[model samples]
Target: MSRGSTLAEKIIGRAAGHAVQPGDLAVVAVGMAMSVDSIAPSVIKVMREEFRIPKVADPEKVALFVDHVAPACNVSTAEGQAEVRRFAAEQGIRHLYDVGTGVCHQLMIDRGLARAGEVVLGSDSHSTAYGAIGAFGTGMGATDIALAFATGKTWLRVPETMKVELTGQLPAGVMSKDAILHLIGRLGIDGATYRAVEFYGAEDLTAASRITLCSMTTELGAKAGMIAFPQERLAEFGLPEWLFADPDAGYVHAETIDLAALSPQVSSPDDVDNVSSVDAVVGIHIDQVFLGTCTNGRLEDIHAAARILKGRRVAPHVRMIIIPASDDILKQSVADGSLISLLEAGATVSTPGCGPCIGRHQGVLAAGEACFSTANRNFRGRMGSPEADIYLGSPLTAAATALEGKIADPRNYL
Candidate 1:
C-alpha cells in the first residue's frame, strides 16, 4: 500500500513526475517566475553575462514588474526600469506590469497568473503570496531566478509540512490580519523555519483573507505556505483531490488558531514577530497611517477601512495614505465609492503599486516619527530612518489609528 503524502509532497511529486517526500530535492518546471525592477537588472545580467544563455525556455512564462521604487524614484531607478523594458520587449515577454500596476504577487493573482497545484517563483520573499491560490510559490535568489529564466526550471528541497489548523469563525471587528499576527506571535520568528505550512481548516476564511494568511508565512520563516481546499473551494480554485493533504499525511508540527477568540493584533516595530493585541499598544501616537501592500491591499481590505472612515475625518495631526494593490482594485474602489470615502476622510491616494510598503518613496517615515501600516515586515529601518517606528495591523486597525491619531483598537470604531 502507498503511504499518505502531504499537500506539498503531492504538488511537488506531480511537478516532478514522480513521488516525493520531505527532504527530497526536486527540479520542476516553473509555471511562472517573476522579477521586480530592483533585482531584474542583476537577474538579467546573470543570465546574459554569466551563463550567456540564448533564448529563455519560455518567455511567456516569465514576468517582470517595475513596482518597487516605481515612477522613477531616482535617475538610477529610471535607468534600471528602462533596461527591464528593453529586455522584455526584446525577449517577447508580455507579462511586464510597469509603474502604477501594483505589486508582483497581487498582479499575479489579479491576472490569474497563479494557479492551484502549480509552482510559481518570484525574486521577492513575499513571493510566497502565490500560495494563496494553492500554488507552490517560493522565493529564490537572483542567481537561481536567472537560471530559472534561462531554463524554465528550478530545484527545491521538499520541506517538511507543518499543519496549522484554523477553526471557528472570526468575531466581528477582527480581520484575517489579526489571525496571522496571532499565529506569527505564537510561532515566533523562526518557528516554521524551512517548512511548508498548510492551513487545514481554512474554509471560514474569505478568499482575500486566505491570501493575507498565506503571504505572511514568510514571516514564520516558512519555505512554502498552502491551504487545503474544501470540496466547494476545490472547484473554485481548480484544485485536484490530491492537492488536499491526505488524512494520514505526516506533519513535522501542528497548531490550531481559533479565530473567534482572536482580537485585533499588531506587530510592533523592528520585528515582524513582535506582536501583541491591539489593546496592549493602544494610544501610541502615530504620524501616518498607510493602507496597502500585497498583504492587505485588496478590495475587501479597502472596504474595511472605508467602513471605519466613512463620515469620519482623519485626525488633524495624522496623515492617511491608501494605495490599492492593483489597477483593477483601484477601479473597483473608485466605482464602489470606497475610494471617495477614504479621500473625503482626509486620506491621500497614490498610484496603485507598492507605494511605501518598501519605504523607498510615497510614505517614508522621518526620524522620531511613527506609522501604522498594513504592509508586512516592520524590520528596523524597513520604511525609512531606523529611528522611525512602524506598527503593523489590519486596515480596520489602521483606519482606527488615523481616526484617533494613535494606535487605537479597530473594535472600538467598529
Candidate 2:
C-alpha cells in the first residue's frame, strides 16, 4: 500500500523523480533558482572563483533580480549591479529583471517563472511568497544558489509537515497580515522550526492573500510554506499538479484557525510576536505610514488602501509613503487611478521598488518616532534608526493610520 504523503513530500518527491517520505535527504532538480542584487554578487563570485564553473546548467531556469537597492544608492551597490548584469549577459542568462522592474518574489510569479507544484528557491528569506500560488518555496544562501546555478539541482532534507487549516471567511477589515501575525504570536518565533507549513483552505484565500500568508510563515521559522492551489487557477498558467496531501496524511502538528473570530491585529515595536488587537493599541501616535513592500504591495493591497484614502488626505502630522511592489503593479495603479488618488491624498508615492521596507533610500524614521508599516519584520533598525519604532499592520491599517496620524483600526475606516 502507498503511504499517505504530505504536500511537501509530494512536491519534493516529484522534483526528485521518485517517491519520498518525510526526513528523506533528496537531491532534486529545481524548477527555478532566484537571486537578487544584494545576493547575486556572492553567487557570481562563488560560481567563478570557488567552483570554476564554465557555464550555468540552465541559464533560463535561474532568475536574477535587481531590486533591493535598485538604482544603486552607493558606488558599491552600483558596481554590484553592474557585475550582476555583466555576469548575466556573459552567461547567456535571459530572465534578469533590472531596477524599476519589481521585487524578486512578485516578479517571479508575475513573469510566469513560478507556478503550482514547482520547487523554487531564492536567496531571500521572503522567497516563501511564491507559496501563495501553491509552489514549494523556500530560502537558500548564496553558496547554495551558486551550486544550484552551476548544477541545476540542490539537496534538501525533507522536513516534517505542519497543517494549518483555515476555516471561515476573514472578518470585515481583517487582512491576511493580521492572521499571520496572530499565528506568529501564538507559535512564538521558533514555533515551526525545520518544518514545512502546509496551508489548507484555498477557497478562502485570494492569490494576493495567500502570498501574504506564505511570506510571513518564514517569520514562524518554517523551512518552507506551501498551499495546494486550485487546479482551475493553475490551469490559467498551464501548470499541472501531480499530488496533494491525502485526507489521512499525517502531520506532526495541526491547528485550525477560525478567521471570523479574528480582529484586525498589530505587532508592536521591536518584535513580530508582540501582537495585540487593534483596539488595544488604537490612538497610539505614529510619525510615518509605509504602504508597500513585497509582503503587501500587490494591486489588490493598493486598491484596498486607495479605497480608504479616497476623498481624504493623510494627516498633516504624519508622513505617508507609498511604494508599488513592481513596475507592472505601478502601471496598473496608475491606469486605474489608484496612484493618483494616493498622491492626491497627500501620500508620497515612489518608484516601483523596495523603498523604506529595508530603509535604504526613502522614508527613514527619526529617533523617537514610530512608523506603521505593512512590511514584514519589525526588528530593531529594520527600517533604519534603531531608536525608531516600527508597528506592523495591514495596508488598510497603514492607510487609516496615515489619515489619523496614529495606530487606528481599519474597521472604522472600512
In the order shown, the candidates' Cα RMSDs to the true structure are 1.2, 1.6
What TM-score quantifies how close candidate 2 is to the native fold? 0.96
Q: Candidate 2: where is the Cα deviation over 4 Å?
A: 230-241
Residues 308-398, candidate 2: write the lDDT tens digits.
9998999999898888899999999999999899989998877777788888777877789899999998999988889999999999888
Candidate 2 to native Cα RMSD, angstroms: 1.6
Error of 2 at 360 (Å): 1.9
Which residue pairs collide, candidate 2? none
Taking the tens digit of each residue's C-alpha lDDT, what string does model 1 give over 333-371? 999999999999999999888888878999998999999
- Cα lDDT, model 2, residue 45: 88
Which residue runs of candidate 1 sit more than 4 Å off their true CA positions? 231-233
